[model samples]
Structures are given as C-alpha cells and as structure tokens.
Target chain A: MIQKWKNHAEAYLFVTPSVILTVTLGIYPILWALRYMFYDYKGYGEAKFAGLYNIKRLFRDDYLWDAIWNTFVFASGKMILTLPVALLLAVLLNGKLRGRNLLRGIYFMPTIFSTAVMAVVFYLIFNSYNGLLNQILNMIGLPAVEWLNMQNAMLTCIIIAAWGGIGNYMLLFLAGLQGIPKDVYESAELDGATGARRFWSITIPMLGPVLNIIMMLAIMSALESYEAIMVLTGGGPSGATEVMHLYLYKLLFPVSTGETMAQDIGYGSAVAMLLALIVGVITGLYLYLSRKLNDIYS
Target chain B: MTRISGRILTWTFLLITAALLLLPIALAMLGSFKTNQELNAGSALLPKVWQLENYLYTWKEAKFSVYVWNSVIYSVGATITTVTVCSLAAYAVARRSFPGRKLLLGVYSAMMFIHMGVLTLKPAYQIMVTLGLHKSVLGLIIMMTGAGGTTFFILYAFIRSISKELDEAAMIDGASSFYIFSRIILPLCAPALGVVGLFAFRGAWNNYILPLVFTMSQPELQPITVGLANIRYGFGGAVQSHLMLTGACISMLPMLLMYILANKSFVQMNVGAIKG
Candidate 1:
C-alpha cells in the first residue's frame, strides 16, 4: 500500500502542471465560455444572467446562420478540391522530375506567405478598379468583378484558402507516397499490372494509412480556419462571409448603433462556447471515422 | 499505350500546378521592384521596373529592426525554457514506469482534444493581469512556454522509440540520472530536439493572434507578423497595392531565410511528425 501510494504521488507530481494547464486554460475556459453562453456578457461591462437567452437569440440570429452556411461551403469546397490535386501533384513529384528541389520550394511558396499577408495580396488581386484580377478579366473582355463585395466574397475566400493550403497536403501525400516500397511496383510490373491498374490496386492500398491521416488533418485544419476568413472578409459586406470566430469577434466588438461592447460579454462567450462545441463534434467524428484514432496511439 | 500517356499527363499536370503556386510569390517578389504607380497601372508576370526601395522602406517602414530583435528574443527565450522543462518531464515519463504514468499521459493527450486557444488566451490574460504582465513581452514568452510544451511533448513520444538499453548502459557507467540525461540522453536525443526546436521556432515566429489580443499599446514590441498586419491596416486598402506588396515581402523575409537554410531538416522534420 505504501509503495503504491508513493508511486501514485510521484506520478501525480510529474503530471500536475499539464493537468492544471488543461484545467485552467483548457477545460475551465470551455466551461466558463459555456456559462457565459446564457448571459449577455459583452467585452467591457456587466452582463445580465439571462438564462438561455443567448442560445435562443442564436436561433433567431440570421447572421449566425449566414456565417455558419459560408463556413460550411468553404470547408466542403476545400476538401473536394484540395485533396485530389494534392494527391496527383504528390504522385508526380514523388519521382525524379526536372527541377525537383526548385519545384518543391515553389510549390510550398504560398504556405510561407502569412495568412494576413495573403489576405492583403488576394485583396489586391481581386480589387476592382486597379486590381490585377480585374485587369486580367477586363483584358479578356469579361466583366470586372467586385471581389470582396457581397456577391463574390465567399467564393473568392474559398479559392484563396485552397490555393494557400494545397501545398501542405501535397507534402503530406508525398511522405505517404514515398513510404510505399519500390518492390511492389517492380513485382506488379512482372504481373503485367500496367500503370493505372497498379495505382488503383497497389498504390491505393499501400497509401491508405497516410491518405487517411491526411484527410483527418485536412478536416481538422478546415474547421479551425479563422485567419483566412478574418483577413479576407472581416465577416464581410453585411456579414455575407461571416464565420464562427469572425461572428464571435463581431459580437464582442459590435460596430452597430447604440452598441455597448461590455454589455454583450455573456453573449460573446456563449457564441465562443457554441463554436467550440461545433468544432469539437466535427473533429471528434472525423477522428472516429478515419484511421486517426487507431493510428494515433503509440 | 495508356501507361506512356499517363506518365506524360502526370508531368504536365504537376508542372501546371507548380506554375500556379509560383504566380503569387513571383508577383510579390517582382512587385517590390516596381514603383507604386506601375504596380497599380498594370502588374503582370514580370515587374516593369525593379525598386529595391520597397525592401528598404519596409524595413524602416515597420521598424522591423526592432521587431526582428523582439521576435527573436521572445521566441528564443520561450524555446530554451520550454524544451528544457518539457524534456525533463518527458524523460521522466518515457524512462520510468512510475505510478499514474499512463494516466498522466492520457490527461495531457486529452487536453489536445480541446481547441488550441479555447481556455488558453482568456484565463492566461486574467493571470497576466494580476502578474502585471498584461502588456509585456515577458508575458507572451511565458504563455508561449506553456503552449510550447505540447509540441515538445510530441517530440517526447518520438524519444520513446529509442531502446532502453541505451539508458541502462549509461547508468552502469556510474552516471547519475542528471549527468546521464544531459550528457548521454540529451545528445542522443538530438534529432528529437532538432524537430522540437524547429517546430517551436516556426510556431513562435508565425504567431500573431496572441500578441494581437494580449498587447495593444506596445507597437515598439510588435513582431513581424502583427507588424505586417498593422502596415496593411495603416495603408488603407484600396490604392496602396505597393505598400501591401511591401508588407508581404517583409513578412516572408525571415521565414524564407529560415526555410532555405533548413530545407532538408525541415523536410526531415515533417516526416518526423508523430503528433502533428
């Protein structure tokens, strides 16, 4: 009993800091955010204990759903477009191609551009009057676009997200593609397994584990994205491209008439918690369905 | 017949994609060379003129001289402390079969499931407010130290891959655990340490959100990331494409230097991802 107790004590000491951090910074903030969900707690001042008020307000909130809808469309669009492109690119570059290092450097270029910077760049490209994007369109005799304005806002943001992101996925796929033993291709060639058939049968199976992890990573990243949306649109021309964090930001720092920031702290915290839960569920489901959980354990 | 065609198609597809990726960065680089009017009038695949002034102006413009020093100090300070503390903790867990070790590992891992910033910035601010670190870079360093431990913990998992016999040999050589750790274990742990240090560096360097929320008054103390964002806002969006391009150039400078110097190690580190 004494030995076991001593062991437990030592274990407790080792783990204490992490436990405390997770509680104070991780778990406690979540519950705190949850509690504030019901009240109208704004950033600066006193919040009323309006039970279920914020949650109810969320249902009646049109902008909340609009943000939700935009975020969904963006996330879905990223998955479909980014993955196959990354996979194909990885497969091509996995071999000895000309300018391989230069290509790798170039392909990974946009990712190195900070999202805030990319937002400015994309904003420039999509600008109407003197923007490069409009300049090209007009040259081709197509109508010039008002990119960040209402109509093209979400679509443009999605394209930017996809562009900046695809490289990281490609790298991950490259790692997976490299992991497959060359022997399989050698043996498959002997069996008259031509290129397409070999890829379908051998490469896919060999690559399953890595591809699964990449998908999980892609999903997690998609859900967690805030910077791109924040920089690109600021929840937009009448909240057209508003996302969860952007919406929370707006709620906390409302720019409307007679808006007192301090008064809405509770509501902001509530939105924060709801957003946390929504992301948590999405990630949890992805973790479960994909090979992430099984493969993660050491 | 299809096999040859497919191979040809693959190269074409990748080349086209690579070209698309090249477009923005190439534009940003050349944009720095052009005068503001030229960039606005008509920017294309190439710059009409080369203006090294954008780089010079950006350096002075953001006072990035100070920003770079500040960023280096904070990130390095956090890196040194975080690696030491986390490696100590990780050593204890990976080497010893003490009580609650599994439980302790589970608790830390479970914390990973929570959103990265959910409770972190808020309560951290509350604590910082009390510590009077609210607007200080030291406060940012400490917060980063705490967050920085998680990535190192992932590196810790990689440490488990090495055999225990290595530790046993050191112990038999009359080395104290401390001596053995610093002398033997730590040296042998270089690859893991390298991965952790690089990760910590990239994360700390790229970080903007923490500074944005935590400190508002100290523009002098701002890092490159936040400083670049401020430049964009200061310029006012519409007609300031050159200034915006200058901001992009400034932000990418340190990262580009780091990437070029460490590209091999960087690639190796990604392949080393255990928890990321």
Candidate 2:
C-alpha cells in the first residue's frame, strides 16, 4: 500500500512540471483569448461588457473577409504545388540510385534556413530591376515581369513557401516509402506491374496514412503562415497578401496605424475565434481521417 | 534499353528539380561574395571577386554577434527545457501505470489539434506583462517551453518504443523510477533527444513572429532573423543587394554548418519524426 502511494506520487511529480507550463502558457492563454470575445476592451482600458458586439462587428468587416479569402487562396495554392513536388522528390530519392543521399541533402537544404532570411534572399532573387529572375529574362530576350506587384504577390509568396517546405514533406513521404516491404514490389513485378502502374497500385495506397498526416499538417501550417508573408511582402503590394493571421496581428499590435494604435483586444479576439473555428473544423476532419486510416491499417 | 532510358529520364528530372530549388540559395551565396558593381553587372551566378568585407560589414553594422549569442541562448535554453520537461512527462505516461495516465494522454492528443496560432498572442502578451516577462529574450524562451505541442507526442512515441523489460528489471533491483528514468531511459533515448534537440533549436532559431512581437521595442534583444528582416526593410532602406544578402547568409550560416556536419542524422531525424 505504501509502495502504491509512492508510485502515484512519483508519477504525478514526473508529469506535474510539464502540465503546469502547458496549462499556464498554452491552454490558459487560449481560454483567456476566448474570454475577451465578450468584452469591448483595449490594452489598458476597462473591460466593458459588450456581448456579441465584437462578433457582429466581425461579420461586417470587409477587410477580415478579404483576408480570409486571400488566406484560402494562399493555403490552397501552397498545397496544390507542395504535395506533388514533395511526392515526386521523395520517389526520386527512394530509388537505389548513385548519389541519392547527396541529392536528398541538397533538396532538404532550404528547409533548415530561417524563413525570414530565406524571404530576404528570395526578395533579392525576384527583384524587379536587379533580381536574378529578371536578369535571366533579359538575357533570354524576354520581358521582365513585376513579380512582387499586387497581382503576383500571393503567387510569389506561394512559390517561396513551396521551395522551402517541400524538403520536410518529402522526408515524411520517403520514410513512408521505406516502410513498404520490398517483397510486395517483387510480387507485383512478377505479375508484370511496372513503372507507373506499380506505383499507382502499390505505393499510393501504401502511403495513404502518411499522406493524410502530411495533408493535415500542410493545411494547418499554410493557414497559420505569417513569417514568410511578413518578411516577403508585409501582407502588401497594397494589402494584396494580407492573411487572416497577419490581419489579426495588425489588429492586436496596431503599431504603424497612427491613430489606430488603440489596441482592440476584444474585436481582435473575435476575429481570432472565427479563424480558430475554421482551423478547428479542419482539425476535426484530420482527426476523423486519421482514425479511419488507423482502422484500415490495423 | 527501356530500363536504361527510364533511369536516365529519372536522373535528368531529379537533377533539374534540384537545381531549380537550390538556385535561389546559390544566388544569395554568390551575390553575398560579390561587389555592388558586380551585382549591378548582373554577374549573379559567380562572384568576380570574393568580397569577404561584406560579411565583416554586416557583422558589425547589424550587430550580428550580439544577435547570434541571443539566438544561441534562447534556442539552447528552449531546447533543453522542452526535451527535459516533455521527456519527463512522456516517460510518466508511457511507463508508469499511474492514475491519470489515460487522462493525461488524452489531453495531449487533443492538444495536438488546437495549434491556436496567433490567437494566443493577445493573452500571452498580457500575461507576459503581468509576469514582467515582456521585452526580454528569456521570456520568449519561457513562452516556447510552454508551446511544446507536437514535441510532447513525438517524445512520447519515442519513449514507448523502448523495451518495457528494462523498466521492470530496474524496478526489481529496487531502483526508484526517477533513477531508472534519469539513468536508464534518458540515455537510451539519446537518439530521440538529439532529434528533439535539433527541432527545438531550429524552431527557436528560425522563429520570427514571436521574437518580432516580443522584441518590438527592444531592437538590441532581437535575434538574427529579426535583425536581418529589420535591416532589409527598416534600417537598411535602399541598401545594396550585396549587403542585404550578406545578412541573410550570416543568418543561415549556423544551420547550414550544422547540416553539413550531420547531414545523415538530420535526414534520419526528419524521417524518424514522420515514422511516428
């Protein structure tokens, strides 16, 4: 009985520190943010009860709607480009070819750099007059394009994101590929299933679990993306690239908006709750899909 | 003949894609070593003369050394806190047959989906003010330790992979669970810890938003990422590409060097993460 009590104490002791930090830092802030949704308060002002006013204001905010639409465009654009390229790269690296490790290392290089730093490097490379892309274009006797203009701002951001992100996802897919038993491929080969047919039949089905995991992660990240957009365009070329999170950040901080520097903590929280609802839906889908995949796997 | 042709096609495609992906980095590295005159001449692929002075200028003008040290402190502090705290909790749930193990595991699993993103910023900022942790790098590290969302699950899965018999045998020897955890489990889980450390350090080092938001008024306390971003847009307004690229290169140098040294392990760690 003494030993049982000791075991319980020991276990609780081991887990308590982490639970405290997680609750204080991660969980509590979220609850606090939710609490702010019902009050109309700025940073230093008194919290006046303005029930549902923030929510009503959120519905009428065109900028918020625009930011949401732009975020969707950015996230979808990133997903559409990132997944196939990462899968293709993973497949290429999975082959028993010479210098595969070297190629893999090179491919994964971009994933390691700071996104802000990479954004700057990309900014230089895509510069309108002195950029590498335009220089190449001029050399090839072609017209130079305004890559960071309002129309192309989001596209440029997507391209930059894909360049840096493909490596991490490719590694995930490669791990999944390596887990597949070789005998499956050999038996398929015995039946004369070669190339695309073999890949479509065996590899794709085998990678389904990892694919779902990556898809969930990719969507979550693409939605939460701020650093690259902040560094590259600051959600600009005339707010063409303002994402939901960036807009929320602007609302919370309110740095450069001279008179608008009055921090609207409540309204910002309302906007954030709406975005969180979207993320929550996606998270539910991901959870449901993961359980289904686990069921299939088992 | 078809086999040979297919192999060639695959190689060609891989090489082209690799080149395309790496070209921007290559341009930055090359441009960093060139003169402004050379950059203006459009000789971007290779430097006519390696201007090492650009690095020196950036290091001094941008206060790279201070930012580098700040980043090292924050990243290392955060990584240690995460690995120690999360591994301890992971071990409890993974090994010990305790009362709340199931509940703790459920909580962590649910927390995985609630990323919270920028929603935590307002409340976190307010909390930091109340606790007097704002405007300092250590405060940011404290915030990071709290945000170990996926890291906890990854470490838990890793701890679960270790054999149960070891813990049982250690218990039979009258060894305390803490002794077994500290002496037996942690050392055995060194490889996972390395993976966690790499991730923790890299995430903190590359983190831009938290540092930017926290260190908004305190420029001197900023890390290299914030420093480089500020120089590019704020301080180094209308600056030459060579100098701007130099700052970017300096920010990337540490991770690049780490990758070069442990290329194999980095790849394995990334792959190991997903295999969980």
Candidate 3:
C-alpha cells in the first residue's frame, strides 16, 4: 500500500507543475470566462445579476454581426487561397530540382517573422500615397488605389495572412509528400500514371491524413486571426477588417478615439463565448467527419 | 531538346514563385536603409543613398533596445520553463503506467482542440493580478509556459518512441528514476527538445495578444510585437513608414539569423506532426 502510494506521489510530483499551470491558465480561465457570460461587469467593475443581457445585446448588435461576417469571409478567403498554393509550392520544392533546399528555405522564411511586424511592413507597402505597390502601379501608368478601403481591407488582410502563413503549411505538406514510399510513385508511373493523373490517383490518396490535419489547422488559425488585422488596419477604414478577436480586444481595451468605446467585460465575455462556441462546433464537426473518414481508410 | 526546355521552364517557374514570395521581405530590407524622403519621392526599389543611420534612428526613437531585451527575456525564459516542465511531464506520462496516466494524456490531447480563444483574457488577467504577475515580464513568460499544447503532445510521442529496454537496463544498474530521466531519456530527446525550444521561443516572441494585454501599463515590459503596434497606433498618419519598416526589419533579424544558422532543424520541425 505504501509503495503504491509512493508511486502515485511520484507520478503526481512529475506531472503536477504542467497540470496545475494548464488548469490555471487554460481550463480555469475558460470556466471563469463562462462565468462572466452571465454577470454584467465592466472588466474590473462590480458584477451585477444581469443574466443573458450580454447575449441579448449581442443578438441585436449589428456591428457584432458585421464582425462575424467579416471574420468568416477572412478565414474562408485565407483557407481557399493558402492550402492550394501551399500544396503547389510543396510539390514544386519536393522534386529533385537543383537548389530545392535553398528554395524551400527561402519559402519558409516568412513563418519565422512576427505577424505584427510583417503586417506593419505590409501596411506601409499598401499605403495610399507613397507605398511600394502604389509606386509600381503608378510607374505602369495606373492610378493609386486605397488598398485598406472598406471593400478591400479584408482581402488585404487575407493576402498578408496567406503570404506569412503559406511557408509553414508548405513545409508540412512537403513532409507529408516525402513520407510516401518511392515504390508507390514508381509503380504508378510504370502503369502510365503521369503528372496530374499520378498526383490525383497516388499522391492525394496517400496524403489523406496529412491533408486533413493541414485543413483543420488552416481553419483554426484563420478563425482566430487577430494580430494581422489588428496591426495592419486596426479593424479600420470603418471596421472592414475587424475579426472576432480584435472585436473582443476592442470590447475590453477600447482603443482610445477621444469618444470612448465601452469597456464591458460581461458583453465581451459573452461575445467571446459565442465565438468559442462557433469555433468549437465547426472543429467538433470536422473532427467527427474526419474520424468517420479515418474509419473508412482503415 | 524537349526535356531540356521542360527543365528550363520548371526552373523559371520555381524562380518566379520564390521571387514573389520573397519580394515583401526583400523590400523591407532594402527600404529600411533608405531615407524617409527617398522612400517618399519613390518609384525606386533601390535607395539613392544607403542610410545605415536609419538603424540608429529607429533604435533610439522607437526604444528598440528595450523591446529587444524584453523579447529575448520572454522567449528564453518561456522556452526553458516550457521545455523543462513539458519534458518532465511527458516522460512521466509516456513511460510510467501510473494511476490517471491515461486521464492525463487525454486532457493534454483534448486541449489540442477546443481553443477558448481570447475569452480567457478577463480571468487570465485576474489570475495574473492575484499572483501579482500582471504588468511583469515574468508573468507573461509564466502564462506562455502554461500552454501545454503541441510541445507536450510532440514530446510525449518522442518519449514513447524510445526503447523501454534502456529504462530497464538503467534500473538493473540501480539508477533512480530521476537519474535515468536526467542522464538517459533527456539526452536521447535532444532533437525533440530542440524543436520544442524553437516553437516555444517563436510562440513567446511573436505572441501579440497576451503580451499586449499583460504589459498594457508597463510599456518597457512589452515585446517587439506590442512595441511595433504602439508605433503604428500612436503616430497614426504622421509616423514615417520608412522608420517603421526599419523597426520591422530589426524585429525580423534575430529570427532570420536563427533560421539561417539552423536551417536544417527548422525544416525538420514539419516531421514532428507526421510522427505524432
């Protein structure tokens, strides 16, 4: 009994720090955030018994709805562009071309830089007057356009996200490609399966699991994208690029504009909870379907 | 002749794609050395005169030194804590058949999904306040170390992949569990540790939201991400784009240098997911 107790103690001792910190920082805050969903408070202010008021406010809040719409558009836009481009790059770099490793390294460079830094740089590049893109346009005798205008802001954010992100996904896809046995491709080629045919028939089937993971990652990252939009546009040109996380930040920290945006923790928590639920449902559904697909594969 | 042309075509396509991908970063590097006036009077990609003084101006004007040190501290502190704590926990879970071992692994894997997003801000702040970690760089590092995400799962897999007979051999010689862990398991897991260290470093270094929230009142404590955002918002329309680009390049330098030095290991990170 004592030995069993000691084993248990040792196990607990080994795992205690991680478990405590994860619970404190991860699980506890989530539960706490959920708790804040019910009460009315302004971040540090006193809580009042205002059940579901925040949710009701959220339901009627058009700006919240607009932010939600913009987020989906942004996430979908990023995934749509990023995955295919990454796959193409991965395929190109996966070959026995000269300087393949050098090309791959260059492609993967953007993944290392801070998003805020890149976004700031891109903001300058996309600046209305003296930006690089505009300079190029003018040199070619085209008029300078506002890239961060209401119609174009989300697209600009999407492009920047894709530019910084494709490298990482491409690396993942390259690894996935390399994992396939040479014999599989050789056999396919011997049977006259070449180029697009080989890619579809052999490569795609083999990369099933990796593709699922990449897709899931793309979805999750896109959904939670805040930094790119926040740094580049500040959800500006009339809130065109405001993603859900930025909306949540604006709720709590209300970026000062002389006329203060309300700092309501309760409302922010409710919106955050709703956003979390949407992400959760989408993730859960994806996982469920992917598991079913895995069963079929097995 | 057809085959030769095909090779040239493929090479040209790859070259163009690489150039397009690298153009923004190259522009930032080049533009950082230009005068603000040259940047303004510009259709030129190349600066008329290389203003190496732009670096010094950005360093002083933007307080780049303070933010760089803060970033280094956060990345190093968080990386060490995360790697140490996570490797210890991962070893315990992956090796030992203890009570609640499965339960522990399940919790870690479950967190791999179910991202609560920024909703944790209020309570995270509260916890920081209670622990007097708010507005402190150390607090931000602690919060970062608490993220038992990809690193934990990857380390768990890495530990599991090692042979069990090694542990048995150590036991036969009367080595303690801690001794075996320190001497045998850790050294074996160095490659995995390197990958985790890189990831932890990048995550802490690039993290904008947590540091932004934690170091709101303490400007000096903020990392480069928050610092750059401050420069963007504070100056609004009046801020010189060239100066900001110089700051951006400054922020990119360490990561770029690390990647260049350890290019092989950086590419090897992708395999971690495939193994998992």
lDDT of 2 by residue, A34-138 (tens): 898899988775999899999999889998999999999999999899889899989878877799888889889999999888988888777777677888888
Q: Residue A273, candidate 3: how far off, in angstroms?
A: 1.6
Q: iRMSD per model?
A: 3.2, 1.8, 1.6
After aligning candidate 3 to the native by TM-score, how far in Å is the CA of A188 from where it should be? 1.7
Work out how many backbone clashes candidate 1 has: 11
Ordered list by DockQ, greatest first = 3, 2, 1
Model 2 chain A — which ten-residue stretch has the worst lDDT?
A254-263
Classified by CAPRI criteria, candidate 1 counts as acceptable
Using lDDT as the measure, which candidate wins?
3
TM-score of chain A, all candidates: 0.83, 0.92, 0.94
Off by more than 4 A, model 3: A255-260, A289-298, B1-9
Candidate 2 Cα errors over 4 Å, as ranges: A256-262, A286-298
Best-performing candidate as measured by DockQ:
3
Cα displacement (angstroms), candidate 1, residue A248, comes to 2.2
User: Residue A251 CA error for candidate 3 (Å)?
Assistant: 1.4
Error of 2 at B74 (Å): 0.9
